[model samples]
Target: MLTSSNANKKRTPNRLSQHLDVLLFSRTRLEGIKQRRAMWTDKQRGIRLSQHELLCKNSCGYYGNPAWQGFCSKCWRERVRPAEARRLDTRESGEVTTPTFSKFEEKKNMEKGRRINTMRRLFWGGPSPPKQPSDSQMNALKAFQKLEPGDFTGFLKTLRSPSCQRLQSRCTAFLNTMEAYHALQVQKQSDLVQDFYQSFAEYFTSFSEAELTRTMEHVEKLIMTRLHKWVFCHDSCDDEQKDLTLQRRIRSLNWVTPQMLSVPFPEMQSTITGDPFLPAITAIIEMDAKRAPQDKLVCVSKCSQHVFEALSTSNSEPANADDFLSALVYVVLKANPPRLHSNMQYVIRFGLPQSLMAGESGYYFTNLSCAVAFIEKLDGRSLNLSPEEFEGYMRRGRAPAAASGVQAAACETRHLLDELMSRQERLDHGVDALNVQLQTWVQAVHAQIDQATSQLALVQEEVTDISLSASSSTSSDSAEIEHLILTDEHVGSPDTDC
Candidate 1:
C-alpha cells in the first residue's frame, strides 16, 4: 500500500543473506573437523613417543631419555660403586693390625712335619742306602759256595753229631714227603677249582657269553663218560647182571606157535571168556548164504579173515583196509540214529531181509567193502559222487514192504534184487573207475606241459645267448668309444689338415 511496502523490504535482506552463508559454512566445516582430529591425535602421540624411544634403546643398553627423571642420562655418567669406592679409601688411609697364636702354632707344626716326611718317602722304599754287594751278588755267593755239601761251619759242627743223627732222620723224611706232596696238590687243586666254579655257575645260569661258549661246547660233546668200548661194556653190566642175562635168554627161546597159542588176542578177546568175535561173526553169516546173486562177493572173505586174525593175534597195527572201509562207509551212510539197525526204523519202514549171517555177512560185507573202497578212492580224485548219490545208496538197500513180513518177502525180494544189482554194479563200476582216473590226469598234464615247454625253450636259448654276448660287448664298447672320439679329434686338431 505504500508502494507495496517498498518491494517487500527488498526480499527481506535477500533472505537474510542466504541464512548467513549457510551458518558460516557449517561453522567452517566444524572447525575443519576439529583441526583434523587434533592433528591426528598429535600424530598418534608422536608415534608412541618414538616407539618408546626406539624400544628403550634396543632393550636395555638404554641410551636413555624417557623424558628424563630417574637416572639413565645415558647411563648416569658411567655409574660406579665398589662399596662406595672402598669407603672413600678407608677414609683417606688410616690403618690397624692383629695376628698371634704362638706364631700360628709355629706355622702349623712346620706344615705338619713336612707332610709326615712326604708320606714316609712315598710309603717306605726310599731311604736310599743298602745296595753294596753286586758282582751279581758276589757271583750268587760264589755259586752257593760250590753247591755247599757240608760247610756252613760243618753244618753247625754236624749239628752236634751222630752223623748229625743221620742227617736229622733224613730231614724228617723229607718233610713228610713234602707234606704228602703238598696235600695231594691241594686236593687236586681243590677239585680243579670246584670244577671251574661249577662250570661257571652252570654256564652263566641262562647263557650269553656267546651262549655260554656254545653251551660249553655242547656240554663237552654230551659228556657221557666211559669214552666208548661199547660205552664201556654198557657201563660194566650189573643191573642184576643185566636181569639175569635177560632171564636166561627168555628161557632158551622157541618162537611161539600152536596156532599162536590158540589165537584169541583180538585185543585179548574182549577179556576172554567167550565172544570170540561171536564165533567168527557167526561163521561169516553162514558163508554169505552160499553166494549166487552175481556171486555175492561182498562177503569180504569172513571180514577179511577176521580182520586178518585180529591183526595177527592182536599185535594191533593193521587198520587201513581202505581206511577201515572209509569208516565203515561213513558208519553205513551217515550213522546218526542208524549205526546198523536199532531195527533201523522198523527195517527202513518194514521191508527187513538182511538177516545178517555168514559171519554176520562177512562182517557186514567187510565193513561195506571197506566203505565202498574208500568212497571209491575218494571219488577217484574228487568228483564226490552224483548219479543221484549213487542211486540213493542203491535205494536204501531196498526192502520196505510196509515194514517187511510175509515171511520176509521172499528174502526181501531176493535181498532187494541182490542189493539192487550190487549197487548198480557198484555204480557202473564207479563210472568206469572215474573215467580211468580222468584219463590218467590228462596224461600227466600233457607230460608236464611237454617237459615245461622244453625247459622254457632251453631257458630262452640261454637268454638269447646272453643277449648276443651282451650285444657283442656293446659293439666292442662302441668301437672303443669311436676310437676315443677319433683320437680326441685327431689330437685336438689345430689345423694340420690331415
Candidate 2:
C-alpha cells in the first residue's frame, strides 16, 4: 500500500509538472499575441496619422493626377463620387441656352476668334500667319469715297449743244490724230499712263501727294480697263463700239480735266484757246521761232508769260534749238493733258519733247546729234540757220518705224514665252495630279492586302483550332477503343475467375 501510494505521488508530480509547463507555455503565447496586437495597433495609428497629414479626407495625397494612385478606394470617399455637387450647380443654373448672333455680330466674332487663334498659334510656335493689308489695298480704300459719288455715264450724254460745235470739232480732230497714231504705234495703256505722268507734272500739282496717290488709284481702278480696251481692240466704225468708247472717254475726260488743269483755268470744253486750238499750238511755236521774243506772236495762257519772262532774262542761255524747243513743249503739255493717247499726249509728251530737249548732254540726252546756229532770241540763245536746215533737222526726228518694229518684236517674244510657260505649268500640274492619284491607289492596294492578310490569319487560326479539336477527339476515341479491347480480353481469358 505504501509503495502504491508513492508511485501515485510520483505520477501525480509528473502530470502536475507537465500541466504547469503547458499553462506557462499558454500564458507566454497569450502575452506574445497581446504584445504583437499592441504593436500592430501602434503601427496602424502611425500610418493613420501620416495619412491624415498628407491626404484630403479619406483620400491619398495625390489628386487630379493621371496616375492610378490619384485615387485610393479604401482611403477615399472621393473614389465613388455621387455627382451631387456637379448636378446641384447645373440644376440651380436652370436650363442650358445657346446664344444666336446677327450677320455683323457673327462676322465680328469670327474675326475676334481668328485673331485669338492666330495669337495662340504664334505663342505656340506655329506656321506662317495671315497676310496683312498692302499699300495698294490702302490706296484703294482712300479713293473708294471719291469714286462712289459719280454716275458719270448719265452726265456725259448732255454735251451736244450747237454752241459747243467749235470745241467739238477740235475734239474730233484730236480723236482722229489718236486713231491714226494708234494705227501707227501699237501703244499699251499701261505705258501710256507713265507717259501721261511725264507729259504733265501739273497732274500732281493740284492735289497733295497722298490725295494724288489716291487719285491715281482711282484712275487705275476706273479708267485703266476702258483705256486698255481702247488701246488694244478699238473699232469705232462699229457704232456699238463707238458709243461705248465715246461714253467711257467722255467720263474719263470729265474726271481728268480738273486734275490736269493749271490753277487759274476752269474746264477744258470752255478753254480760252479755241477754234483751231489743237493744231494752232505747233504752228504758233514755228511762228515764234521765225520772229524775235518781243515780237513773238504765240497765243498762250496769261501764266505762260512767266516762262517767256524767264526765257527773255540774260541769266541763262539755251545752248541749241532743242533747248529753245523744250520751253514750247513744257508749255503745251502744261496747257492741256490731251485726251489723245498718241496724237496730242504722245506728240507733246514723247515725240516733239524728245526732239526738242535731246542734245549731246551728260545724263538724259546721252547719245544724240546737235544742230547748231548763232543768234539771240527768247531764252537768250537761238539758232540762226535757214528755215530749210531747221525744217530738215526737225523732220529728221526719231524714226517712228524703228520704234514700232522693236515694240512689235518684243510683244511677240513675250507672248510666245507666256504661252510656253503656261503649257509647261499645265503639264507639271498634270504630272503632280497623276502622282497623287498613283500614291493614293497604291495605299488603297496596301490596305486591301493588309485586310486580306488579317482575314487569312484568322482563317488559319480557325483551321488550326479545328485541326487540334479533331486530333483530340481522335485520341479520345482511340483510348476508349483500346480500353474496351482490354476489357474484352480480360472477360475472354480462360482463367478469368482469378
Candidate 3:
C-alpha cells in the first residue's frame, strides 16, 4: 500500500507538468495571433494617415483625392456637385454670380479679356476706360453727336456717324448672342458664325447683293477682329501651349537638313547654292502677315502650288498626294511661320464652311495643318535617323556661334569651296562631252577601215580569177598545136615510106 501511494504521487506530478505545457502553448499561440493582427492594423493606419496628410485638405475623415478639388470624392460627387449645379442654374436664370475658374482657366480668360480690350482701345483710337479721349476719339465723338454727320470717307468716321448707329447697335446685339453661345459651351462655333453672316445679309435687305456683301465683309472684319481673342481656343488648354512648345522645338530643329527629312525632290538634295523650295517657304511665311482667313488660305494655296511645281519639275510622273504632303512638310519646317497656332485657329473660327471645309482651299489648308502637326511631332523615328544623330544635330543647334572673325573666315572658305565644286562640275560636263565625241569618231573610223578592207579583198579575188582563166586557155591551145604537129609528122613519114 505504501509503494502504490508513492507511484500515484509520481504519476500526478507528471500529469500536472504535461497539462501545464499544453496551457502555455495555447496562450503563446493566442498572444502571437493578437500581435500579428495588431501589426496589420497599425500598418493599415499608417497608409491611411499618409493618404490623409497629402490628399485631405478639410480633414473630412474619409479617403479622397486632390482631383476632387480638396473634398472627399464621395462628398464632392454627392453634396458639393449638387450645390454647384444649383448655383449654375441660378446664375443662368439672370442672378448675378461670380464665376469660380481654376487658376489656368482664370489666366486664360484674363488674357482673352485683355486682347478684346486692346481691340476696343484701337477701335476707339484712345486710351482704355477712365482716361481722356485721344484726338482720334474726340473727332469721332464730335461726329457722333452731330445730327447730320457728313460724308464718311474713312472707316473710323463712318463708325461714329448717326447713320451707322444701326450697324453699331446690331454688332453689339450680335456680340451678346455669341457670348450666350459661348457660355452655353456650344461645340459648333463655326456653324454659329456662319448663321450670323447669313442673318446679316437678310437684315440688310435694303442694299443690293453686291453692296450687302461688301458691308457684310466690313461687319465681319470689325466683329471678328474684336472677337478673335475671346473665341480663339477658349476652352482648349493645349492650343497656345502646343504653339509655344512647337516653336521651341522647331527652333531647336533649325539645324535639320532637307536630306534628313527625305525630301522627294532630287534637285533639293543636290543643290548647295540655293534651295528649290524657297518660294514655297516664302509663301508659307507670308501667311502670318495676313489677318483674314481667306487671305491666309490664299497664301497656303500659293505655297502648295510652288511645292507642286517643284515636285513636277523634279519627277517625270505626276506628283501623288503623299509626295505633295511630304514636300509640304519640308516647306513648313523650313519656313517655321510665325503665330502658326493663332492663324490656324482664326481660320477655323471664321472661315466659310464651303471654302474652308470642301474646296481646293480646304485641301491645301488641311495639308498645311498636317504639315504643322508633323513638324511638332518630328523626332528621330519620324525622320528615320538614329537617336544619336538627331541628338547630335540638336546639340549643335543649341551650341553658341563662334567668334565673328572665325565665322567670316569660315564663310570665305565655304564660298571658295562652292566655287571650286562648281568649276569641277563644269569641267566634268566638258569631259563627258569630249568622251562622247571621241567614241563617235572612233566608231566612224572603224566603219571606214572595214569598208576599205572589204573592197581590197574583192579586187584581189577578181585579179586571181582572171589570171587562172587566161593560163588555162593558153595550156589548151598548146596541147592542140602539139597534136597537130604529131599528126603532120605521121603523114610526112607515111609519104616517105610510100
Candidate 2 lDDT for residue 16: 96
- The lDDT for every candidate, in the order shown, is 0.38, 0.38, 0.64
Q: TM-score per candidate, in order? A: 0.17, 0.20, 0.42
Best by lDDT: 3
Q: What is the alpha-carbon lDDT of model 2 when measured against the actual structure?
A: 0.38
Which pairs of residues collide in candidate 3? none
Candidate 3 per-residue lDDT over residues 1-498, each given as its tens digit: 999999999999999999999999999999999999976554333101132343335565543333344444335445653465556455664755545557435655665577456444433333343244456645544443342311223454567566555446656766766666674432345545655665545544545544554455555666676666567656643566767877787787766555455455554234433556889999989987766666677899999999998887767789767677778877876787887887776776575444444446766776666567667667766665567776866787434222443575577669789999999999999999999999999999999999999999999999999999999999999999999999999889977988
Which one is best on TM-score? 3
Candidate RMSDs in Å, in order, are 51.5, 50.1, 21.3
- The parts of candidate 2 lying over 4 Å away from their true place are 1-400, 495-498
* Local accuracy of candidate 1 as per-residue lDDT tens digits, 1-498: 987888889888988999999999999999999999976554333101122332223244332322222222223223422333345445544573323657545655664566445333322223332234445434433333333332334333433344234323433443343334443432232222223323223313433444333333222222211111112112222333543443333222212111211232333224333223343344334432321211132333454455455444444555433333332332222221111221111111111112211224423442443333333233211222345543443354433222333454466557668989999999999999999999999999999999999999999999999999999999999999999999999888977665
Ranking by lDDT: 3, 1, 2
Write out the backbone clash pairs for model 2: 58-75, 58-76, 311-379
As a TM-score, model 2 comes out at: 0.20
304: Cα error in model 2, Å: 62
Task: Tell me the TM-score of model 1.
Answer: 0.17
